[model samples]
Target: MSDRDEQAYAGTAEGKGPVRIDEELARHLENKREELFEEFEIRDEFPPEVLREAEERAADPEGDIRTELEDRRDLRELTTWTTDPADAQDFDDAVSIERTDTGYRLWVHIADVTHYVAPETAMWEEAMERGNTVYLPAYTVHMLPPILAETVCSLVPNEDRLAHTVEMHIDGETLSHESIDIYKSVVHSDARQTYNDCEDRLEDPDAPLHEANSLAYELAEKLHEQRKDDGSLVLNPKRDRAHTIIEECMLKANKAVTHTLQWDRGLEAMFRVHPQPTPQEWDEALQEIQELDGVSIPGDAWDDPRKAVNATLEEAPGRQLDKIQWAVMKVMPRAKYMADPFGGHHALNFEIYGHFTSPIRRLSDLVNHWIVYTDGVPDGIGDLCDHASDKQKDGETCERIYKDFLQEVGLDPHAVNNRGIEVVDDPADAEYTA
Candidate 1:
């Protein structure tokens, strides 16, 4: 559920509940969501057993997490931090890095969700049923209950949390993996930084984690440059520094884990396979783009459609972005989850790719965590892939419908997405910025 191609349909995150709307509008919104949920067979409620299990695990996270500290790597001394959205609820991942003489030592510590929601647990069953978290502008239907994410699984600042860390020694000159290690560990996030905070720190020399943040961006920029140079299609090339940092880090870490699973272990797990557009499809898409007003496809980039679209996007008129994206989307096939890493990921130009981040939200990551932990493949992985793929498409469709409904009710989906929603008795009583 990488959904990097998401700009094709929608947006990103930060959570503060809901935007202020009157009761009538609120009722309408709720009804619409209900309709979408019913239509897509989305389960918004956890069974009683699942909720009780989550509650028990959440009741004493400190005690539970403390019990496992004996055998795990103690990384509390590391200057680790999480960078998420302004209103993020649970931080599932944190990063720490050091510049080595030969390369950079990067550590990506993810919430050890599998520790609490193991294969035989009620929570695991519920998560598998949900497939992935469904996010609709101001609301989110979580795969795992909020209790687990809020307590045991969240990498909250200043809290010692169990983690699955992916440690990589990346060669500075080659930007290639010199070495990679994945292990269980204990991590203490020093701070929870918003994307804006990351940007501010990058500019402030005296700020805490400034040097580390700068180093991260330096490495991130290198990774990004290398990715684009390798013929990766960046639908949105003008992404901010903060987004770039997370994107590159996660991509590299995911690549590292899947590469190990496929090449080293020869295991069948959840792998992402993105099909490339045919030459004719690419030509037609390019022709469509070229025909658009204030758009041009460079002569040199024609051979690589990915590069051509990327270049066009970087220079194309802002208003025509949706059109250009639509053209490409029409020609491209939907990326799907597979038991094997074959055909690769086309948009990313990655030979092997899979999910290992955001286990709280994505079933694929959760399943991969189990695979890596037990060296055991899930039964019927191919069927599971189809279920995940179908559920993902369902979530996307539901989100689109929800957003459309919001617009019809005189609300901005973007505003609601960024600011969240609040239900009030009367719309006039609610204070709003715009």
Candidate 2:
């Protein structure tokens, strides 16, 4: 190798330096590693039978699609599109909008993953076992194999992919069940855009896909206002116009699907439930908030904690915002998948909610799809829900552990600022200095 190449590789190569890991950090890392494998299988390879079925379906994905022409709308000609992260591989959902005489007709198209992976199949069982995709910094463990998630079942641009659509006729930006219909659909996405571009073009009058993008922005604004009015918490730090648009669109679709499965069909399915915190937990959360922000909340704040939390966040100092939000979120109970339908989502302020958007990565969504199509759930659904909920927690734990390791090694995963702490020579006397 050349001298320059050797110099470039010296400090960067794997074995060039002796990495120092202190005893405390080392023990924590080891414990986290054990917890990871104990809770998650980390399975990546699919069985031969499952791969064979996926390949067969990929070849003729829509040959045997069972959408009734009279019932299901033929929306392939509509100007539909998807917006996601720049690095996203699986395109699971799309949106289309048009102005009607009464109001706006909005179409949310979700990829019909269950149409490919049927019930009681090997592929279906594997998906249930995986529960959902576990995405780490290095790699992703997809719930469905990549063959389907990245290629066939993904709602790619200009491709006619089968979908289960929620068609809503909005008058003045409100969604009513009377004007919404759920049915199978065939969609051809006009284009695929990224979240960054959507944000950039939020007000571009002549931007590509201007009509749909503009309408989506208006609808999302209304929905966001409604959510705030209904006492929903806005804890996400990265809330923006583009993010709000996509979030509201997905929320509308998920709410519609859940309403159909629970209220219309009365089918037994897994619901995404978020229970309210007990009085003790609420007291603890309030205590943490007071400790962080030094702002005392009223005793009656528990009645409408969303408003209290958001109001406190506005007054929270800039430097303490991140840590304060983290502490507050740590006190909140985790949302889980449940078989019961009546359990409401406390966070979203929904009376009923279910995972119905990304069947490509979530088994809970696939179960919802199965219920939609077959009008019944497969055997062992209760066990599947339990496993999925556990795996979801495991996935979060694994990501946290991995991110911690990355942060210690001077790599901030979010990349907002440099988090490189200085290392003391004694190893035992490690401390940070400006």
- TM-score of every prediction relative to native: 0.95, 0.82
Evaluated at residue 150, the lDDT of candidate 1 is 67
lDDT, candidates in the order shown: 0.86, 0.72
Q: Which stretches of candidate 1 lie over 4 Å from their true place?
A: 1-18, 431-434
Per-residue CA lDDT of model 2 for 131-204, tens digit only, reads 88876543466888899999888999977888888888877745453477888888889888877678667768
What lDDT would candidate 1 get against the real structure? 0.86
lDDT per residue for candidate 1 within 342-425, as digits (tens), equals 899998999989999889888999999999999999888999899999999999899888888888878888778777878777
Reference-based lDDT, residue 341, model 2: 59
Clashing pairs in 2: none
